[model samples]
Target chain A: MIRFFTNVWNNFKEYIVLVILILASLIILSQNKSPQVQKVRAIAFGSFATFTSIISDMFSVTDLKRENQQLRERNAELMIQISKLRKYGIINEELKDLLGFKDTANVPLIPATIISRSLSMTQNMLTLNAGRKHGVLPGMPVVNDRGFIGIVHSVSEDFSIARTLNNVDLKLTVMDERSRINGIMKWTGEELVIINIPNTFDIKIGDRIVTSGISSIVPLPLPVGIVEEFRPSETSGFSYIKVKPFVDLKPIENVFIIAEVQSKQKKDLELNFYRRQSDEIR
Target chain B: MKFDKIFPFLIFFVGLLVQVTIIPLVSINGIVPDLILIMLVYYSITRGQLYGTVLGAYYGLSVDLITGSLLGSAMLSKTLAGFIAGYFSTETKRDINISTFNFSMIVFLCSMIDTLIFSFFSAFDFNTNFVTVLFEHALLPSLYTGVVSILFIFSPFRRKRLL
Candidate 1:
């Protein structure tokens, strides 16, 4: 019996690490009730993902070449549209003035290369080449030539992580560029969709969607995407709309991070008004 | 312990670099093979359960760092896989090639576990339906990982190094 106990002890030392790891997992699972713990968990996971993405980007040089060729071709097609828009500059200017617009604001776009993409099964995150050095910060909006991509969530010294609109975690205040009906855009996991718009909202397929600038994270009137499909929710009073994301993230290379753009004072004013109203009732 | 201890880490790092670099070029719809799982299986079969468990935990940590999923998520799945795979280690016949068949099964199982854990966490985070998690990302990618393992058996890594 003594020899048997000794043998078990000898073998126990070999698998001790695995036993400890399993125990740690159980502890985390049990202690994850606090929202603060969950936030830390999310941050840790995000950092880990950002690190892996950077390492992977170091090896994506060859793949980036092929992606660059595609982007260049797309860039040429966009230039034609830019030229046509330039031709109608007078009419656009008049329209902008009528709609209460700012003068031609020189919003300097800090462009960066795509460092790494999330191949993970959960969230859709993309790492950008720009970081704190380039004035990129959390909550800053990112875009491509097509439209709104996502918002930066985390920043390292040399890279920033953008949580694409494909992520279900993001909620953007958006409206149909044609109909003026506003809604919140969110990813539905299976498809990019919008919520909070009433069924009677005047939205249609192919109607261009743009940011309402209500959210401090994004500038007003930025292109979001086009409405693809719409249907009334089965169990709700609101309608659901599917949006095909304007930014084709799969072939992403260079993206522009918009900083020093959003008007935070407007957001603060709205928040204060709401708080005051609520306080008066209380 | 010298070669046994150091070899898996070496293979783990190599697998990680290759997974990031080489596998992306070969995937369809950005799904790459699970190279770390294959290495875990390979070593688990050669070494005993204890060795398998240790390497599995080490490999899982590396995978968690490299893949960017939840922190202990890969560790839990991989340690379980290593323990389970190690149970069948001493039973296999020595002369026969276990790489091909063993590699396929491990890829299938580990991919399923990895995907399921990720999707489960995603659903918790995003409030998406469970079905979407299973159908959207899990099914096809796991199949692709399995197919890649079959091809990996024929690659020079298997032939030249006799690994």
Candidate 2:
């Protein structure tokens, strides 16, 4: 027995260490969702992103000219659209004033950069430079020059993680632009899916999908994706639709955190809904 | 352990930095090469089992902290990979080299084990097909890591004995 024990210790010391370390890892995994560990991960990953961004910036300089040209073109297009929208808004306001309609609230945009991305297959998250210090909070919406990206999942003082739109874990209220039909959006592994759309809806390929804006964190009519294909779901009464996101996420560098949010009263109600939904998941 | 042994470990850490920074730019369908796994495999075959496991834990912890993964998934995956690689460890360190097919096989196997465990803990979902993840992520990444390891063997650092 003594010889057996000695031989095992000599031959399998690494496995013993592996077992002990795996146990420690399990403990950490169990607490992975806690706010305390989330904060720690935020701080540590924030610093790591900051450090790596410095290196990425060096390599990215060579592509600056091309990226700058593309941004300039996009900026011009957006500016023209903004001017058109302003004219429409002015006309609408004048009509609303005559009708005694209350003015709508508008929140400011907080611009940020995409620092890095999570390499996990199931968890599609992006690390952004904006954080609590920049008034970025969890559940804040993220967007790029193209369209809606995701919502802030967690935040540190100087950095926050955004759950990308392609992530399977995120369930959002999305609308079909043409038909104005709304559905729940989720990742279907092979593609982004808009779930539970009834077969009766007059939806089509190339129709724009945007945020239904039922939630406070998301502004209404935010562009998300375009419908790609549709198939009958297992649920029997619904159409399982695939959507191709406007933002591919690959080669994405410059993005904005649309810190635009609703009033506290409205936001609190939506937050309660989200909290309940999350609780039900667990 | 000799103080100079720490230098080679620093070289291994560069692999971690590469994994975090450069690999993402070239990721093939979100399956980035596991440079740290390859490093652990190399060191295990060159050194011994006990040394590899401890170093693997450290490297994996660094990855978990940097990537904000499910906290301990990488740590467990990497520690287990190191222990597995240690099985292929040579008795004598003098003959250790990465040129042979044997070295690549060890790296390939170790990397597959690393990815399998990592995706299992961090990415296993009821929605996505497990077979898809196993093919695109675990198997593909292991193959890519093995190819990259072979390339590194011919690099100047290894040739000059700096790694």
Candidate 3:
């Protein structure tokens, strides 16, 4: 038996090793959600991101002059828009006061730069320079001036990884700005798509999509994308709406992490409501 | 011999550095060349099959951990890719494979397997069209990696070290 085992090892050693490694990989894949794996991943990326940030900074300096000029022009344009919005803001505040509405719009923003990006067809990720030290936490919404980028996935001491809108694993609840029809939006590998919209929905091409207020991940109604294609599935009686995002991940260097997740009070209220319903059924 | 054994890992780190930092700049429609896979194919062709298989696993796992992709996706894909690339590691043809255009073709083959397995694991959805997934996630990236591998054949270091 020993001799036979030795013969197998000698003849098909490569195959044996391959099978072992593949099995190990599958096992590790299964353990992705385990706390230990997440900790190790955090440490690994945290260490590597230090070097990446230096290299990224080196590249960024060359583009600074051009970016500065663009920013200056954008600042001027924004100044004009801000003045116009100020007039609306005063009227909105007076209206809110008359209606006895509470303000919940003030959320802190943590500024960070993209240190590196792992761009793939499905698992696109960005490493940012902000982390736990900067009050950036997992599930915080990352956005730029243009619009929503993604949710922060993991955070280390000095770095955090975010799954961009292009990542397949990230699904968001978004609504059509015009029709107010809510649908689940996700990256379909080829494009950003809002899936399972009923055919009777009033969504149309050129309609703007925004994060739904009902979404737990991003409770704020933030701009997401514009509907570019509306493919109605005849048999399924549903539509797949393709979206073109306002923020392009490629050229974006700096971003702001909205330092908030779904409110604990809201979550508890929802949980209690579900518990009450379950108890009533019992 | 010790230096030779460690050389591939050094190349992998440098390749990964370039991959994360420089590769994104050249990306077309979110498709970028797999510099790490190109380096893996080169080393696997020079080394034996057993060596290649083990190296591929290490490379894949490292990438997953560092790049924050799905933990085991790259590991599985790269292990198979390395095993397949090892078929051309015969002593008689190693030099020809490395120095000629065949290297690119081999890189293409390995990259296809790598990307296909990765996409299948990370992005496969029942609603998605398989052919579209294959073309966008596997074929285009492999072609880009294969085309980029051509530069390796003509590098000054190739003539200095391999020839």
Candidate 4:
């Protein structure tokens, strides 16, 4: 017994240093982030959403009568607006031109519902009613009519957890839709703030935020939010900013889970990289 | 040990529900009371250092599982706090009645240490706004837990001999 313990201890220091070195290297290399990880994560998130949807099916506490009434009111308002737009003639012309512009048949949406919310003053997270069986996976982008919320992280058979833009851990590769200036989006725990841009960047309040496509996980040109606040950093290079997320996470009702319509070539490209990385790690 | 088998598990569920649900509703700034620390302190005062250290680890693990932060973060902090509280238990005056004031002081000290350790791990540095975190998260929750201990300390659970 003494000999066994001594032998293990003798080997422990060498193994510990090797493990630490490997971890440090991975951190440095992966900080730029490999898009393949994002895609796999999204798939895992999709699975979680599918599971949550199943569980929610078993029980619901919402007042159906009130929900039906609200839906009817919204539909009536939309109909009235549509009629008004037609009377003006410009709405038809604009919509007709838009319909002629591009094909949207390729990308399909899986519907998911919000199950729970993390509302601590300092931190926030969301659980969705969906998961694996419904094709929800980790790294899948969650959004509502307003804009992008955040990516799916973990998935269980019946439910999945997500971190929103409000979460400090959430980081998205984003750019100014107008100026095309690229930067990363992050949340600082103190407030609903997203900081870290160099002063040289051409960013302005009300400038539309969109996914930069630099990250394979995030689809390009998807609306994120509007820049709400900006201030110069004490050091010369960066400007800190706050964004008003388009979706009101406090009252998230319905969300759309997007299945990225990756071309066969792109799918192979990512899978190849992942396979290589896994092999190297092992 | 039989008490350990049952009471800790019971405390975990009750503490977690109160931690995630009830405490959040009543907090000054969404800062929930630390039920685990309160229970640990109670045990530490009566049980001893070894028991307190073990309970602290269990409490921390439960929080980590529920919150889904980095694993072991809470466990590390909780264990340290439990060990420190154990040292105090040895010196506490046996005749001094456990009063609201006494409970307040014990909880305030233990939770302050808990908050400082948690913050240190989550952030790489202790340089930013220690006063705010210590006051808001640590001090407020400690006071709230202290008030709860006043009621719990006299309950039937305490009537049974700790041994």
lDDT of each: 0.67, 0.74, 0.87, 0.60
lDDT per residue (tens digit) for residues A1-282 in model 1: 999978877878546756786787556545545566545544544455454555655655767666774675465336324533533352476787699865433455667666555556346677676777899877888877776788887666666777888776678898776776778888766677787788877888998777774556676356777899989866777887898877776766677776755666867788899999999999
Candidate 4: residue B76 lDDT (0-100): 64
TM-score of chain A of each: 0.70, 0.76, 0.88, 0.59
Question: Model 2 — interface RMS deviation?
Answer: 2.0
TM-score of chain B of 2: 0.86
Score every model by TM-score.
0.76, 0.82, 0.92, 0.67
Evaluate residue B96 in candidate 2 and report its C-alpha lDDT on the 0 to 100 scale.
55
For model 1, how does the per-residue alpha-carbon lDDT over B34-151 read when each residue is reduced to its tens digit?
7777777667766767777777777765554444344566667777767765665666542133455666766677667666765565545434666766766677677777776787
Better of 1 and 3 by DockQ: 3
Scoring each candidate complex against the real one, what DockQ results?
0.37, 0.59, 0.87, 0.16
A118-205, model 3: which lDDT tens digit per residue? 8577999999999999998999998777778999999999999999999999999998766778889999887899988889999989
Clashes (backbone N, CA, C under 3 Å), per candidate, total: 0, 0, 0, 37
- Model 1's DockQ? 0.37
How displaced is residue B76 in candidate 3, in Å? 0.3
- TM-score, model 3 to reference: 0.92
Per-residue C-alpha lDDT of model 2 across residues A37-104, encoded as one tens digit per residue: 88777877777777766766666665764677467446534633543354345456678678885533
Ranking by TM-score: 3, 2, 1, 4
| Model 1 stretches astray by more than 4 angstroms | A1-19, A26-104, A261-282, B1-3, B48-70, B91-97, B124-132, B156-163
Q: Best by lDDT, which number?
A: 3
